[model samples]
Target: MTDAVSYPEPLAHPEKRGIELIESSERHGRARDLFPVWAAPNVSVLNFTVGATLILLGMELWQAFLVIIAGSLPWILTGIVATSGPAAGTSGSVITRAIYGIRGNRVVVAFFGWFISAVFLALNWLASSFMGAELLAQIGFTDPVLVPVLVTIIVAAITVLVAVFGHSLILRSYPVVASVLLAIFLLVTAFVLPHVQWGYTAPAPLEGLPLWSAMTIGFAILASSPLSYSNSPDLARYLPTSTKPSHIIAATALGGALPAIFFTSVGALLATGIDSAAMDLGIESALLALLPAWLGPIFVVGVIINTIALNGMTTYTASMAFQSIGVPIRRIPSAVVVGAIGTALTIYLVMSTSLLDAVNLMLQLLVLISGPTMTVFATDVILRRNRYSGDDLFDEQPGSRFWYSGGWHVPGLLAIGLGAAVASLFLTSSVWTGPIAAAMGFLDLSVPVSMVVTAGVYIALTRLAAKRRPTAIPSIEGAPA
Candidate 1:
């Protein structure tokens, strides 16, 4: 396999490579480096918003805490999937070619990978802009119209610049970013804890079926944050193949899950003291109202910085997704394109819709696809025993091992399709409600249901295909015959 062309210092030049394989010569970094890479993004005010939404969804303080912990647990699967990066020395988008075949994988990457990631980029930008605009207003630039537009542009520019700088810069910068955000959030947490009503409950607490339904929806909301990160391999792909898989998994999972749980729990606690009217304005407004005036500007700055860190990874992954989908663009231009699209979406959401409502709907919808997609990825990694050839994965010829059944892997495509279809049946969103969810007293089982169905179907069909035509099975590099 040819080595990826080395570039100059990442800080001085934009990343030139896209989804190309990273050869062993170019691979560097310990598994533990992934901790900050993953953590910096999860240390977000958006996570706090998600936690607050759980309370707004009628979950009690204790129930919201449980949901936060349980929901963030999917970061474990994200960690497992990251193992493929070192094994394959490629982004998650390219690694999936082994599971879905080259052509089939393109379709999956274009829709589930790129489109969803782009939408999230917009959401992150919007969240930061909201906080930023508020900060400007506090400091006397309170033009309702101009402040948002100005903040959105500034935030998008910073985020895209980081993404264009690419992997090395991200690795070098995120630890510092994570440290600053962690300290700020810890301080915020200290102020928040005292205000939490230890025995807080909803105004009119839900009963039996209603309670279960609310909890399920809250779980889906919480789970959506972690599941959106199916691209964990995008960052881990630069780690040496000799890196321990357990270390990779632990670092990535703990890095992401720890902050997510802490920040989200803080949001839930902060919600206990906020009035519904303040919440209606948004989490930023509610949070600022509780914090001392002196800390308000600092919190706002933290939110904006957090958005940049989180969106940097999102944009990087989206650029890789574009390349994985066969876009004839360089990584730098792809980052620009992703940024433009996300900025446009952010402007629209800010001008035309309620941010919280849009966020809730988006998170719920995200679970429908990400759940199954990540499940398939994790399952494939286990079945292959974490062995892959970077060269073979890049091959697109008709006879390449990854080009199954005329460039399609029926088992994988079917697994994801059936899984998403099943998940939709248990979905509860403003967009649509599944009949199964309605029949079961409106319980939303989308997350777990989709994952289980996808894994089961994929295992069954892949085994059947292997038995019928063993040669068609994935080329496991070091497996026992």
Candidate 2:
């Protein structure tokens, strides 16, 4: 018989919330509060560039916007996961053990966690470092290499400090960040829109890539929206348990998708208004040259703020993920460890000549890995109807329901590997494309294909696992008493 869990009121202390199942009483926020957290981070230069790149590659404004809207559709799935947080009362990674077993779940969380945080963190660092170097040059520091190194060190230090303060503070700051960024971008958008040729098309000579290929790139960019689901639970875990799952789902989905659409559409408009060659100089340079003198520096400041905010959240989520890996450290220490390692990587990439190529490679790699992993997790959650024991997530004793197969769920492992393998066969990116993708005229079908394949394989394997071990008690919530 299971002992009843005693959920005291949610603690207000910053240190009290790390890596533990938040008790019922501890949950404090409402569903509507999620909007800023999901919206704020995406209102950045990185997303703008996602739109600009498609136009640079040969897509028309309408085409680019359509592709972006389509790619963002996956966030619907992410919002669904957000709802699981309050009910489960823990980090989503912890709740995953019900599907993959305690030990098996680690593999998924560690890979997805490290990659998602590291890639985005590096991108954020790169953007801020470049701008910082440019600002330094204006003020008389001219060494090409030294300036970037200094900027990276400074930006990474600030980001680490923000992350170390932990969750509640992070939540409080998102709305402020969102408001400032929204105001800045709205002004820029107002200035740029009148100059935009509403019906503009890609120029002849096609910019060296066909329109279809550009659409594929655009799709990959939008897919990053859904891939963000990996960290949404970190925010959602604080909401009141009575917050309806439907409300959680709606808030996260709408909040995230709206900003992404707005910014990306602005990028599409800006892409058509400028000399296409400006695309080669990068989004920041192009925008700086086009905007009036006063507006230019303000744009840079906005990007810097966005960079720090995005990286700060990445660092925080990564620390929680580390703790979920069974590490004995507290949340702040884990944040420090991941922050240092991520900072080192950011500095290296910022200082390197191959920075753009490296960033593209990292994004493609995420597209490859995230699809199957997300599919398996989503399938598990849906099949179980999101029911989870708040107590079981942390229990590791021998008889714990989550300890299946000595902590490894073979079927789950097999499904993920097989699904990712099949998806890689059709992936297209700057770094690599699968043979099948190349054969199919280099169309990127990685995300959809991986989801379908993983879903099918996981469903079949899970059913088989059940039949093969008829007497084995299932670990899912609401299993037979």
Cα-based TM-score, every candidate = 0.96, 0.91
Residue 287 Cα positional deviation in candidate 2, in Å, after optimal superposition = 1.3
Please write out the lDDT profile of model 1 over residues 225-270, one tens digit for every residue: 7777888998898888899999999999999999989888888888
Span of ten consecutive residues with least summed lDDT in model 1: 472-481
Model 2: pairs clashing at backbone N, Cα or C within 3 Å: 9-25, 10-25, 10-26
Model 1 has an lDDT value of 0.85
lDDT of 1 at 32: 91
Question: At residue 94, what lDDT does model 2 achieve?
Answer: 83
lDDT of each: 0.85, 0.74
> Pairing residues by index, what is the TM-score of model 1?
0.96
